[model samples]
Target chain A: MKARAFSYFRAATIEQALDAHALVGDDARFIAGGQSLVPALSLRLQAPRLLIDITHIGELRGVRREGGFLRIGALTRHCEMLSEPLIAEFAPLLQAAAPFVAHPAIRNRGTFGGSVALADPASEFPAMTLALDAEIEIAGPSGSRRIKADDFFIDLFETALQPGELITAIYVPLFKADQRFAFDEMARRRGDYALVGCGMLATCAGDRINDIRISFFSVGNTPTRVKGAEATLIGSSLNSERIAAAQAALEGDLAPPENDEVPPAMRLHLARVLLGRLLGRLGESA
Target chain B: MSGFDENLLDEADETVRVRFVVNGRKVACEVAPRETLVDCLRNELELTGTHAGCEMGACGACLVQLDGRAVHSCLMYAVQADGARIDTIDGLSESGVIADLQAEFHRRNALQCGFCTPGMLVNANELLSQVAEPSREEIRDALSGNYCRCTGYEAIVDAIDAVAKARNEGGSAT
Candidate 1:
């Protein structure tokens, strides 16, 4: 595993990190926990000339509740999210799905900004981001800007972020008491990446599904929210019929972008199973 | 791997000086930009007890103590450990519970070639340190990432259970 030689810059704060990034431009990369980046470097998959280590940035490591929204810092590790009380109450979808991330050790190091910025279709966080309508807060030279969850993801392994921009925090809305949430994923192993996953946030008025948001992953280039399914369920009573219709809509919308990980048929089949089980749970909760 | 971070991983080799307390001594060393902590420990520092089976993060063979918490050294860059504390298997080799774990593993024939014993011991010790009365399922889940092809996991689980039981019964603290 031979990688090209490069220099390491330890940035202790976001200001320091941004300064380093602005100077180095495309030559430099910002490393948070190095959970994913280090492995890629070892495999010779990527070779940048400079590295800006963001692990020591104190401001980027926290989870706090501000009024009606929970602000999760960019460097908040997955394990940290599991223990955060605010996430448990407001964004339980993230809490419930976090255990299914890789393994305990990996989750202890993998960061919130790292996963969302990388925008891996199979990652559990991206789907959760959409389901909760989370706002992605990023830092650039001019300062910070917030992006809507639907607009944050652009393409495969690509985001709307500019080269020098850095994600500093994520803000997810607190659900009303009437809302019910469920997250599910299918992986070959206990700690492996999901083959296909779904995060559902549905509000029930009586037995009718008033508001529904279903984010589907591993079935597209970027994990996407299936609005058709949401529309099909909205105002409809929770039952096998609505769920079946939603599943059908999601299955028809499935497009995995043609990868070697799984054939198209397998991807669609896994998406169906996962979404089916997730809606089933919603049925029980509703 | 779309989740792979290009900035940290793809960067070039920079020999950065870092100081850390390993085992019990403070040491200074120069590490390349992309050099992993596991490679630095095994190759540079000669901490052979902290083994490296899979260079990737899948296998927990390169587990080590970072400020009292067990972490996968492979996933961390050497420069990231500046001023940090590391406790390797060598540090715990002489401890009673660790020795007992080694002995029980031997008694149960948990290893065929003994390649994964050090890592499994570290992971098991870390788990038992936190969750003293971990259920069998918990033990299994904790050790899932640390793989062993030679011996079945039954003996390994038995060794861990016996050690836990002994410690609970207050017999010799072994």
Candidate 2:
């Protein structure tokens, strides 16, 4: 399949990119890495009149620690998550999820911001961001604003990102000394989109889970955090009975959708199984 | 309206000049914004060693090294690769970087139909370069993106594993 003809503009600066997008209005799209956007464009699912290449924008290209958070540029490729020392040190969950994010070739070209901005329900980074309690930085015609990962995702294939808004970077809270993290997903094949995936970040006081965030993807319209499951383990020790209770509490948290390939019942069952397995790992590590 | 509707699709032939290095040689060409690198390589330059299968980026048939990074050529627009260095299957094979792996593939019969060979070699090169001695599982993980309908991947894995072992042996054996 071939994409419809579109005008192209390479942006050297974020301001140039924003200005170009504003000039084209809804007829333009910002392309970085292009792993997702190119596929959509080829399938003719999206045909913007102008494609503003943001890969060359120097300002949106590196990772740095600012204050209490590690700021990851929107243009950060998925493969970078595997090797970037900052990501490995600050956001290990994203690093763990990197290998599971598509094949090596796609990972080389897919950007972290592109995945989060696209907000595909099945993607790993968005859910990992939610687990890490990251904030998404956005720049648009109305200046810039930061939205928490929890509030960024609105629905399936939809986000709080307004039209013409560019995700400049993702600011993830630095991993703490006491934080214990684990990430896992069950897919039919190695690089296939996961049937069910989950990530957990818990701050522990001895064996007790002081504060925990458990997030699941490929289970709902948006990457979801199981607050009910988190509640069951918040004050409790990592024990069999507590883990079972949290697994049982998953019913109140996620309602995975049914499709021709996978029924809702099966998806929910997989989600529960995945949750148990991830929690089991956390419990062992604890 | 559909995205490919004739009336909606622009046929203005708008093109931009892009200069990129392919196979260690600098090349400049005029390409449309919609032209994928695979298409540019196959159609414009007649460098047909890079095949175009599942242009949607699922198949690794169009794998190429862009700035030493293995990427699906079909997923990238030519304009996006402007000023980047590319190493295609032909280039890598010609340079002898993967000569031993190629010999192993031939010895192991990694290809039944041979359609996925070029891309497989490109991916294997990247894997060997990154991982000093990749295990069978690691080779499988690295080549997960590449689809080989024929061969069932066992021979392909055998070839890569053999190459890794041979290389790890301090080049004592071929």
Candidate 3:
């Protein structure tokens, strides 16, 4: 299916993009990398009147260290996560999740901000953002503001971003020397969206998990953060008994809806299995 | 007599001008904002070597290198590619980077129906360029996005493996 005809505007700056979108009102959609948006347009799932091409906007591209956080430009492509030195040194969780996202070709064009802003329940980056305690920066006509990832994603394909507001960058606290991270997912195929995926970051002191943040995707509306399960593992060394307790705590954290492909019961089972495996790996790595 | 559907009329009248380099040659054309790079390539420039199996990004038949990065042409707008350099199967075939892999594919019968060969070759070319002697698992991972309904992929892996070994051994890619 062909997309509905639309006017195109290549924005040279953030202000230009905001002005274009504001002029077009709600009928305008920002196109960066165009990995997910282009497919939606081709399928006619969305028919915006104006496509604000923001890929050329210099302000929206790069990975750098700012103060205590790694400020990754919204337009940073998925492939850049693999090569960017700052990301490797600071936010290694993103680097770990990069290969599991789609494939090399799709990764070459898909953007970090686009993935997080889209907030697909099954996508890896959004959930990883939660695990990493990243903050999303938004620029609007009035002014710019930063919000925690926890409050940013509200629902399926929904975000706190107001109309005419563009995500400018994602700020992640630089990884500490004692921090340990792990990410894994179970997919029918390598490149297919995961059936159940999990990412975790823990501050380890000796053998005990001092603090940990656990996030799961493909099991709920938003990237489900298992705070209850995380609480179970905090301050305790990862052992078989503690892993079992954390796995049991998932029942309270996630309420994944039933789907045709995988029943809700089976999804819960897979989530438990995944949590166990991830915790096992985290124990070894720590 | 068919009625004049307003939406159809609107789509028919809308077109945008785009210019980009394809296979080292600069080309310009007028296309709709919705026109994908694969459509612009096949219909406008007459470069049909890049096939479009799934208009969605899944099938990978519409794979092309944009500014040296491999991407799905079907999932990109022609205008979005403006001022960019693109490389397609036609360019790669003539560039001699995958001549050895092509010959090995022929020798191993890696292709059956031949619909997925161009995309497979493009993906394999990328893999061999990066890792001169990639293991079988790495080749599978690289080609995972591309779907081949024919030849079970064993022969394809063998073909890519042979090329990787030959290239690593200081032999030219035919």
Candidate 4:
């Protein structure tokens, strides 16, 4: 299926993109890499009257370090997450999850910010953001403001972004020496959406866990932070007993919706299995 | 706003003029805002090698090189590709850039129906350019998007593996 006919506007600057989107309001959408939006358009799931081509905007490009955080521009492609040295050194979790985002062709065109903005519950980067405790930078008609990743994702395919606002960049706190990251997803195929995916960043002190953030996707409406499980591992060693406790805690943290293919019980079982595997890996790294 | 801004298409405009380099040739044409690059390349530009399989990003059948990177041409509007350089399977084959891989594929009988050959070739070329010697697993991983109903993909992987070995050993694939 082809997309509905819509006016295309190539914005040279961030201001132009916001202005163009403002002109049409809800009828317009800012297109970054068009990986997801284009598919939605073709499927007629979304048909905006105007497509603000934000790819040409210079302000939304590049990845750089600022103080203690790595500022990754919204236009950073998924492929860059794997190849960019700054991201590899500063935010290795994203690099670990990049290959599972999609295939090479899709990764070549998909943007990190676009994926987060789309807030697909089955996506990797959005969940990783929660684990990394990243900040989402937004440019709106009034002014620019940053939103924490936890507050940015509201629901499935819904974000905190208001009408006519554009995501400018994502800021992740730099990875430190004490941090250990692990990411894995179970999927029927290599590039297909995960049956249940997880990414975690653990801060350890010697053999004990200091702090950890565990985020799971495809388990709920939004990328969920399993506080119950995190609490189970805090100040404890990632041994089999602790890992089992964390896995059991997932029963309260996650409530997989009933679906035709995978029942809720089966999904929760997979999440437990995945959590145990990730925690085991994190323990080895520590 | 500058006078150049006046050239921008309005919301009411049904067609927009776009120009891009295809296979090293500068080509300009008028296209509807909804017209995808795959459609434009096949219909207007007459580059039939770039097939439109799913018309969505799922099928790699419509893969093309936009600015030297493999992407789904069906996923992008032609207007968005204005001023960008595009390389289609027709262009890549004519240029002999992936001739060795093509020869190896032919030798292995990698393709039967051949609907997925162009995309596989384009994607394989991309993988080989990036990784000189990719493991069979890597090759399979790279070709995950390029689905083939026939040949069971074993031959396709074998063909790519052979090409990578020949190229790495500093020998001709033929």
Rank list by DockQ: 4, 2, 3, 1
Alpha-carbon lDDT, every model = 0.82, 0.90, 0.89, 0.92
Ranking under lDDT, best-scoring first?
Answer: 4, 2, 3, 1
Q: Residue B145's C-alpha lDDT in candidate 1?
A: 80
lDDT of 1 at A42: 75
- Check candidate 4 and list the clashing pairs: none
True contacts kept of each: 0.49, 0.60, 0.59, 0.64
Put down candidate 4 lDDT per residue, A5-105, tens digits, no spaces: 78887888888787777666788888988988998999999988888888887888999999889999999999999999999999999999999998999
Full ranking by TM-score? 4, 2, 3, 1
Candidate of highest TM-score: 4
Candidate 4, residues B13-48, lDDT tens digits: the string is 578899999999999999998899999999999999
Clashing residue pairs found in predicted model 3: none
Model 4 docking tier (incorrect/acceptable/medium/high)? medium
For every prediction, compared with the true complex, DockQ reads: 0.38, 0.44, 0.39, 0.59
lDDT of 3 by residue, A1-286 (tens): 8888887777888888887777778888999988889889888899988788889888998898899999999999998998899999999999999999999899999999999989999999999999999999999999999999999989888899999999999999999999999999999999999999999999999889999999999998999899999999998988999999999999999898979999988999999999999999998985
Of candidate 3 chain A, the 10-residue stretch with the lowest lDDT total is: A19-28
DockQ score of candidate 1? 0.38
lDDT (Cα, tens digit) per residue for candidate 2, span A183-228: 9999999999999999999999889999999999999899999999
